[model samples]
Target: MNNAIGNSMYVVIAGAGHVGAHIAEALLEQGHSVAVIESDMKRFENIEAMDVLAIHGNAASPKNLADAGINSANMLVAVTGSDETNIIACVIGKSKGCKTIARLRSPDYLREGVGTGNLDVFGMDLVVSPDVVTANHISRSLLLPSLVESGELSEGQSLIIELRLSEGNPTLRRMLGSIQLPPGAIICSVSRNGQLLLPERVGPLELGDRIILVLDSRMLVANVETAFGVTKGGGTAVGGRLETGIDKIVIVGATKTGIQVAKKLENEKAMIVMDTNTERCQHARDVLEKAIVIHGDATDSALFIDEGLGDASVLVATTKNTDFNMLSCLLAKKRGVTRTMAIVDEPELKLLFEQIGVDMAVSPRMMTVDFILQNILGKQISSTQTTLHGSGITVLEVLVKDTLWMVGKEFGNIKFPRGAFVGSVIRGGKAIKPTRFDTIMPGDRIIMMAPQDSLHKVEKLFSYHSGTWRFR
Candidate 1:
């Protein structure tokens, strides 16, 4: 089996739902062969239009798995809506000597040490949960308050933050090369007017340009906000006197995602969870100790006034209904909520919701795709995280090896491909801000950001093999 992902390999995906179809599309774009097995006729027809072999049958059936060529498949990903089907399909794939990835939603299967840790009971290489991934994304935004989107890298030792240049931002209009950022921070990419620009190619920062930054996780949030001219007060982005903690947060839905969000923030911030379903509300009440669970409609204007929701610093809509989530967020904004977030089922609608008024829109399917892609691409790379909202840029953590060509080269001498940038270097667990004169050393882990097309070149630069590589 090849250890580098730069080469193309055959991949089999089960269930051509949103998650599965998106993963197939991404793999095909990366020059890999793909086949999808979907049980539903409509979904099968939808995915059959793509450049893949589409089979209509139960993914859990061994016959269907055989038809999909699982014996020759390099990897098998099971992302059906049913957890049992996903697990069974993965077991079949694993028995065929194929790498297996399963997307299971039940918390029982997602415990900390079940499939990971010292146990390999699941016979799978990776497992992902859409609810947990989406919940974590929402919680990070609420905790940071100032960042537009945020994610952790290198085992939480580093952070990748996206922030828009507001009107009062100090870095606005400054040349990208001229700004004096914090000691361990670097601008990785900028999204201006719908164009993704590398920091070196970008000129002066403009208003509304979304910039992605890579920095040490220990750096103070306030310092990053100050560097960008964003003011936070009372744990909200609206300027005021600085407070010690987050303000009141209102979540509407009482869903698994909603309950997870409340649980994550219950100890750190005041939480209120509201839903029209009395059973779900009661369930949330039993599960959460600090959150206030209410059995009522969040869209009800009377409930907003009765619960004093206008004082909430943030409002999140996590229901399954897309229109309801958007409407609920708009109502929250009308009630004077400082910021509003919604869970968008359709990835394309994310930008549309943000443009209308929603502060942030997260897609669970997109999150799942990112998680799977990170695992699939982890054969050679140490770790990976992509920018939310489909910016086409990815952050990678790579270990420098003595067998690689650039082991003893200076940062200034190597000609890095276009759209690729080395952000920082970690030597002996300490982050070293990269300079033109710094020398690449063995065992050093380098943090880099690049687009999908340039990944092969980036991988070649750090690959252990001398001539060629394939990762699957």
Candidate 2:
């Protein structure tokens, strides 16, 4: 979660696209009040279905925001796909004493400094770029790929992975009693096409069953591959766009994915190409950088044991050979390294990594498509996956205006949405997990969580703003 988020703020979100809707859902899950202003009829109808106070109107107009209960709101987030639209909504919302944040894609907005010439000029608080985020995800995965992607759904001491079913599945039709899950790990849920997966002690698995499981980070990938049906050595053969580095990253691969990761991360990154091909590495170095290049079979585990990876905090592996990255990560994990990451291109490998344990894995093509589709008119995103990969959640810091509507209301009485988790409360800067008997008074900022579906209802539950929707 971004540091800017807290609990307890009346929020007005403009646009319900991938980022916008994702933010709205996050805010909703926190139990904070949110009113979404959408200009598109279809988008409005869709958001309305989520049970939020969705209004169909022009977000570019101050009246539209006011209608969504903005004047009395504590914050407003503009996530319209168009940078200009987001800027306009945030500018107006900020002027009304509502803290505002906008989403922009221009790197120029994030220049080394902050001021009138940048995002600050528009009264925006945050600037997010799907491309940059996607690049980072890809880079992190390329570094390790062994552990699947990170942060799917993290509960304290636990993580979830979305694994696809593959051929020769050893655990097929076997109950949890039969399968040997790595120590310190347990199967959490088995996600099928569209269902809420619950732990079934006697559940039977079938072919093509996509399992979502969790395991200890210390488990070995090789063991996981053996338990599941994977290529003899987890072959490489990655395929993606190719480019050079903008940051000084030393990737050890010459395959398509290796090239793609390089291309996406290109710009100001002085990348050091490492491979065993003296001629090819030299050629790659010639086109990318003329720095010291290492040429040797990276599959040799002794090399990593010999030369310590540089001070670089990030490592990427897109080598055509999966075993190379996998074994490399196992060695890295043994060194007591905390932030080791990996990228497994195989869709089926998603769950295998979880059964073992890897930091993060990302599907370039799926993420790209999801990111692009998330940019729509008014609303930011639509699906549940996008919500997690997108903003997913928000923290609201709100001052209770000491009104009768909230003064005596108990949290349980509010019955916050299913997904919302109330984290804490702030009384004069000291934070505390609000007690059940906690009575809200004036000048109190309570943090909350609500699903996107509950955003509208949350707004009405605590909204003192005049623009707040009054339902029967």
Candidate 3:
């Protein structure tokens, strides 16, 4: 998990589009040697300009992959726009004894029992689906309007929320340890002026600083809002009071991303999907029986008025066209929609959308990069560890195997390394707040937080296996 020289890996990436290029840049920043293969000459030039080895050739071609050093690569990432090309390149990479990962766009590839083998058996160790990732993120953001970002751990029993400190907040100018945190809540990391700080030695919170908090339940979010003085009129923070629970949802576009979002929200709200393409509208209508699909351009202001956009609790712009998505969201905001979110393809456009009055702007390429990085680097550790970007910490979700070192021992008796702590423990799918008196048992998944350098020691502690079950 640590980016030590001994842990540096050789990674080959196929494709030079936004998703592929972003992944390559991230891997290089983490001290990994990276090579990218792209067919487009312009994209090849862009990758080459980044000071990495760039091969201008078809990624699925054996000669192109060989030129990228596939034989010596530790892993191959296929992320071309075409699903077939990605799958073909991964298959080739797998044959060369390299671990392969594919960026699959079609849900059919992920469908259970689809006649094709599982990802691993199909020559891919993992599959990253940006559409699904974007849809899930939108769903969570819709549910928690106050949270800047939300991620769940411990089988969705524990939650991580990111919120920004603004003026008039109660926690400002106070020592980290002095803040009255709710039960089972902790401030894990802080971001100040684009720099990360651990709570141990960090100074008093400052306005505009982003803080990440881990809690045992979503119920604690209200406490956080009250402590930080965040309200519906707060400045630059997504933390706000929703007038009502999500009841009406309006989705623009019937692209794959739009369709996926509609599918996720259709059951929870009264859904209306709008698209310019008649065929796509028909397809969405057929698939989403509960949703009302309209054949019209989402960017048209007339259409928004006709649909009564003001009544929508949540308006999502999922169209692939960035301009259309941004314009539609602006119109929705003008119409007094409670919340607006747009799926921006370009990272730079996010800031532009925010300045133009959009409530939230998400980048699919950025989200996909995070998903691939976590999965690829996580699989390297025999005991997986996910490196929380920008936070100098690594999180490991490990099962309490039947090892004498851990099983049947009280939490306080075990000697945990410095900078390592058990965040939460899941037993039988129920979250348990770890206490000194609690005894470890087999089949328990313990979520641990550790500094990067100490990850090896943390993993070594749970590496062994004694029998399957153990009683305390």
Best by lDDT: 1
> Which residue segments of model 3 deviate by more than 4 Å?
1-6, 112-118, 153-157, 163-181, 187-212, 218-242, 299-302, 379-472
Per residue, candidate 1 scores C-alpha lDDT tens digits across 48-146 of: 999999999999999999999898888889999898998899889888887888888887887742322211476777788788878887888788877
Off by over 4 Å in 2: 1-9, 16-69, 95-97, 111-122, 134-150, 155-158, 169-175, 191-206, 216-472
Candidate 2 minimal-lDDT segment of 10 residues: 375-384
lDDT of 3 by residue, 1-472 (tens): 2122234677889999998998897666555689999999999999998857899999999999999999888788899999999999999998888878788878778873122223876798778778777787787766665565667665467676677665556667887788777776767667675455767767877876777676678777777765665544222223443344367888988977777778777786788899999999999988886989989976677877887767887789998888888888887877877668898888767656765677678888777776676565552222221234344455666666554456788999988888787766767765566678999987787777777677657755654333222100
User: Per-residue alpha-carbon lDDT of model 2 for 1-472, expressed as tens digits?
Assistant: 1213233557788887655676676556535667898888888887887747788887878778888887788667676767788788888877777666665655456553221122668786555554444555565433322333332212112233334443445566777467665553444344443343445533777654554444334233344444544333332222332112113454666443444456545553544446766676766655553334567654465665465553333445556455666655555555433233345555345445434544344443344333322221111112212222122332222345544365667766667656554544545543444667777765555544344566455545555332222110
The C-alpha TM-scores of every prediction are 0.81, 0.44, 0.69
Off by over 4 Å in 1: 1-9, 49-51, 112-122, 165-180, 189-211, 229-245, 379-472
- Count of backbone clashes for each model? 3, 63, 0
After TM-score superposition, what is the CA distance of residue 70 in candidate 1 from its true location, in Å? 2.5
Q: Relative to the true structure, how large is the alpha-carbon lDDT of every model? A: 0.77, 0.50, 0.72
Task: Check candidate 3 and list the clashing pairs.
Answer: none
Candidate topping TM-score: 1
